[model samples]
Structure formats: C-alpha cells, structure tokens
Target: MSGAGNDAAAPPLAGIRVLDLTRLLPGPVATMQLADMGADVLKIEDPGAGDYARAMGPVRAEVSQFFVAVNRGKRFLRLDLKDQAQREQLLALVDDADVLVESFRPGVMAKLGLGWDVLRRRKPTLVMCAISGYGQDGPFAQLAGHDINYIGYAGMLANNAGPDGTPALPNLQVGDLLGGAQSALQGILAALLAVKMGGPGRFVDISMSDAVLAHNIMPLVAVNNGAEAAPARDLLTGGVPCYNVYRTADARFMAVGALELKFWQLCCDVLQRPDLKARHWQLGQQVGGADALAVKAELDAIFAGRSLAQWTETFAASDCCVTPILTSAEALRHPLFQARRMVSQERHPTEGVYWAVAHPIKFET
Candidate 1:
C-alpha cells in the first residue's frame, strides 16, 4: 500500500476553503472528495435538523452510518439560510473561500438571496457550483428528482433491466454519484483552474439529467451506426454471452468478462469445454439468437455445476477476467481491497474505531 505523506507534503488541495451548503448524497460527496484532498470544507446545514441524511439509515448513538460514509474529513456548521444574519455569516465565509457548492432545487438559493449573482458580486473570484435535477434554465430545471429519475430521463434506466425484462431497481446510484457529484467536482476543479490562470470565477451549472445523458455514449454510438440500441441489445449490455453474469450451484453469482476471442478461448479452455471456444461474439455466433442462447444455456449449466468458490478457484490465475460476485462485506475483506487500502480504519476519540471508504484517485509526488 502507498504511504500517506507528512504534513509538509500535504495534498494538492491544501489551503483551499470550500463552503458546502448541500444535503444528502450528491453535493456532500463532491465536497467530501475535496476535503479528502486537504481542502478546509465547512458543511453548512439548516439549524433545525441539519442534513436529512444525519437522521437517515442505521444510526450508531445518533450518528448515521450513511452520513458518516459520505461526510468524512469535513467541519460542520448550522445556519438558517432564511435568517438574514445567518445568510450574512455565510456570505462572510464566501468572501475568502475558493469554492461554494449547493444542491438545492432551482430558485432555492435565489430565494435565500445567496444566489451566484449575489455571491459573485460580493466576491469576484469565488467559484460557485449549483447541482440540481436539470440546469438552471431548462424546462425541467425545477423538477424534483432522484438518481433513478435522472437516469431514466437520460435513457439509461431503460437499458438496465432484469432477466424477465422488468426494470430493476439498481443498488448503485449512478446518476447521483457519477452525474451529480463527479460532474460538480470536475466543474469545480476546472473553474478553480481557470481562476488560478487569471480567468474569471464562473458559475458551474450542473444538471444531473444532462450529465447522465452525456454518459450514454455507447448506445448512442450504436444508434448513430444504424444498429438497434434498445435495452439489452447493445454489445456492452447483454447481447453477447462473452460479457455476462452466470449463476453458480450455490445460487451465488460470478461475473464473466471474457470479451475478446483470446479471453473467451482461455475461459473455455479452463472450463474444459474446447467445443465452446468457437462460440464467441467475434466467431460468427449470432448475438441474441438461438445459437447464442444455446451457448449461454450450456454455460449456465456448466457454471451451475460448480459453486462460486469452485469456479473462482478454477479461474483464479487465468486471464479470462472471471470473478465471483462478492457482497459488500466480502469486498471489504477481499485481498485486493486490503492491498489497495481502499478502506481505512481510524479511531475517533469519542466515537471509537470507524472504517471509511477511501478516495480512488491517487496523486504521486
């Protein structure tokens, strides 16, 4: 594992001050990433209840695990945005702060008299990022939405369906994590870079729906190439059996990504099924056809003959890109996770020991 350096060799974001007026997942996660990179992040919440996530999910002595999972390495403050005095206090922070992020619906910040126009006038070089369902000037800008709604609007949810063709509720918040938080962070970084290069500080308008739509590139590529790009019909979806999930004998799952002909051949060789080697997406096997279906069924039977552990053990050192579908707990205990130090254990003075998911990006000096 890589060692975290000393205070003098601090992170790139050191000396940056961020004012985060956000709740729930999106904006808080963006600021959390900033705070992890050594920004002095001050999360300002409402005086009455603070962030809604504080009371959500499983609580350990009044602290929510979900809240702590996203809101680490940051300071917290309570401020009533409606109160003139509190708003003035936030504005005072904004004067010296480098960035301000908010995830309110359209017009909410303006209603509080702390909008970008007002804040930019107060501090000319302050970067402000607003995260919402849609952009500030869209027809659906003010519409309330969550991860599912935004991905649905972007035509992504339609592609994610169950085996019975029913739309499955996804556990991963792709729209929230990818679209809102990551997009906001990227825009904030760009705006900060611009200011560092003597450019004007700007308003970063992030629409979750727009960001998700922008990420639906594969299916759009299919459509543009005159191919059918419906749900589960595209190559990357489930059209080919080379890249798919198979059920094990014990009812657990294994993910197979033997996409290339060589990898597929390697996988078939490992399974001792030389006959299946020729049945590949690139080997004239009809995708979504009877032959493909039969091959998948054959694979299903073969995989179901063994337990997840057995199959994983068989393919452990192979280059076929096969892995067991591990649960969250199993993932935490996995050797890969341990080696990368993706999870960190810290002993809080009052709260005892707590494990946190670490940032993925690494900067090498």
Candidate 2:
C-alpha cells in the first residue's frame, strides 16, 4: 500500500510487489509488463546457472539480447530453492510480495514445499499465478511442451497456412505471448482487484494450450455450426480473396484486409479493377470456393505486375485496408511506430544502448 493513496500522477501499479520465479519468455514478459507500470518486480533466479535465456540468442557485453529485451526495469536476485536457508529466505520475501508468478511444470512448486496451499496458509491475501504449457490437473499437465506444441494442440497451427495448405510456423509466439503472458496478466490484475476489495487471494492457473484453444474462436464457431474448418479455407485464414496475402513483382508481400464491401470496393478502385468489386463474400461468392480462388489468382497476377513499393505508394492514400508486409527491421523504422514511440533505446549498464519495446498501455496524468 506504499503508493495506494489518492495521487493522480502515481503509476497504476506503484505499490505492487511482484516475485517472479519465471525465466525465459512468457513469465518474464508478464512481470516485465508489471514492472513497466511501476510495480516492484524482483526476478529471482536459482544461484546455479540462473535463467537459461541469459545465454540464449545473440550476446552483447556478456548478456543475451533476448534476455535484456524482456527483463528490463526489474531487480534481480539469486537463491537456491533446494537449500533450506535459501528457501526460508524466499518465504520471507514472499511475506512482503503482493503477487508471485512462476512458470515451472505443475508439480515442481508443490515439491519445493512452496505450493499455493502452503503460501495461502501463511498469507491469505497473496495472489499466485502458475503458467505452464498445459493447465494444472489436466491430462497433459505433466507433459513437456513449447509454443509450437501448445498452438498445435490448440488447433491454431492447422489454420495458419498459405495456398499450399501446409502449416507454417509463425514468427510470433502466439501461444507463449497471448496464451501465457497476457492471460496471466489478466488473471493477476483481476486477483489483485479482488484482494483490494477485501477478498481472499486467488490462484491463477494459466495453461498456454487451453488459452489458445479458447481464443481459436472462428474455427470453433464453424465446427459448432457443423461446418468444416479446413486449413487455409477459413474467412480470416486466406479463404477469401479480399483478406489474403498477395506477392508483388519484387517478391515482397502485401496484406489485404478488405473484408467489408466498402473496403473491397475501395481496394478494387485502387487496383483499377471495378469489375472485381461485385464478387465480394457478402454477395454469394463462397469463401474458399472456385470463384474466390479465381478472384484471388487475378489479384495475385495484378499485384505481381508491380513492385511492392509501387503497390504501397498506390494504396498509401486509399483507406482500403491494404498494407505492405514489413519485416521486423523495417517495422522498427516505420513512421507509425516512430510516432507512437513503440521502440526506444535504453542504455543498459553493460550492454550499452539496447532497443526496448515500450509498453502498449498509456495512462493520462
């Protein structure tokens, strides 16, 4: 309750203390979001080798850039949970912590004698979040898995494909980020709110696979309606000509999201193909049907006639929901991100100037 007084300028999570036992991506990024909002996040690592991410990917000044990017704005500590003395020390720290987030397998924390039952007996108001590939007490709870496995289990991987209908591995870790991190964030915040209202603390069990499965909404809708949810044959998944990716003469890609008829008409106008506007999904043109594929092929040929840069310029002023597919490096330099300050450089003590992605949340004060 340090900064819980009525102060308009104080950060939202100013008084919150978070004990982070998570390493690598999902758990670390979740706590980092809290830290960005002025929570005091203490990332506790084992005294042995510490977080494996410290050695993952490219290194700069003896630290992994991957680790540096996700673990910014947090304090660090090391303790060996196996040792009684160190375990006692962690328990003492837990006494002062408002929240604890961990990403271990289901039974590891219970085996450590630091399970939710023990912690809740000691402190009833402590919110604990457990993040894992599968939910606690599930058939796959004890099984080891990663982002790819989780998304595949959630039925998302099957739908993420191209015209060839082969499942494509996405560069974005949707299962890890959306499923684990964001879901845990939501649970933690809701539990914190409940505690603020004088309720007992809650245990948040986050399963990456379960989360992604819950969010794979469109395909589920189709299945519930007794329709087939085929790969690359769904409305949002390259099934419709108006919402597909097209390759340009330079082999670069453009994302078209002209789903609505208005946007489709605008896109047709920009492409100088007014005749194509009548063949929209709303108008009896079946999605993933022969007509739709023919229209997509026609659009593809038209797009391949020009360079990506030329198409980008052609659609710059049109509100047709068409945009060039930018690489990660190009996205960092894009004017949209620049204007919003999404990416900024922070001087790490050892790593020098490293790029940091700003928290997307904004508060007016």
Listed in order, each prediction's TM-score against the native is 0.96, 0.96
Model 2 local distance difference test score: 0.92
Cα lDDT of model 1 by residue, 1-365, tens digit: 12466435778899999999999999999999999888999999998889999889767776687888889899999998899999999999998999999998888899989888899999889999999988898689878889999999997887787545666778989899889999999999999999999998899999998999999888678678897554564567777778888999999999989989999999999989988898887989877667776788888998999999999999999988989999988888788988887886776654567877888886766
Model 1: lowest-lDDT 10 consecutive positions: 1-10
Residue 10 lDDT in candidate 1: 71
Name the lDDT value of residue 329 in candidate 2: 83
**Candidate 1 residue spans exceeding 4 A from truth:** 1-8, 227-230, 348-352
Tell me the lDDT of model 1 at 97. 98
Give the residue spans of candidate 2 off by over 4 A: 1-8
Clashes of each: 0, 0
Assess each prediction's global lDDT (C-alpha) against the native: 0.87, 0.92
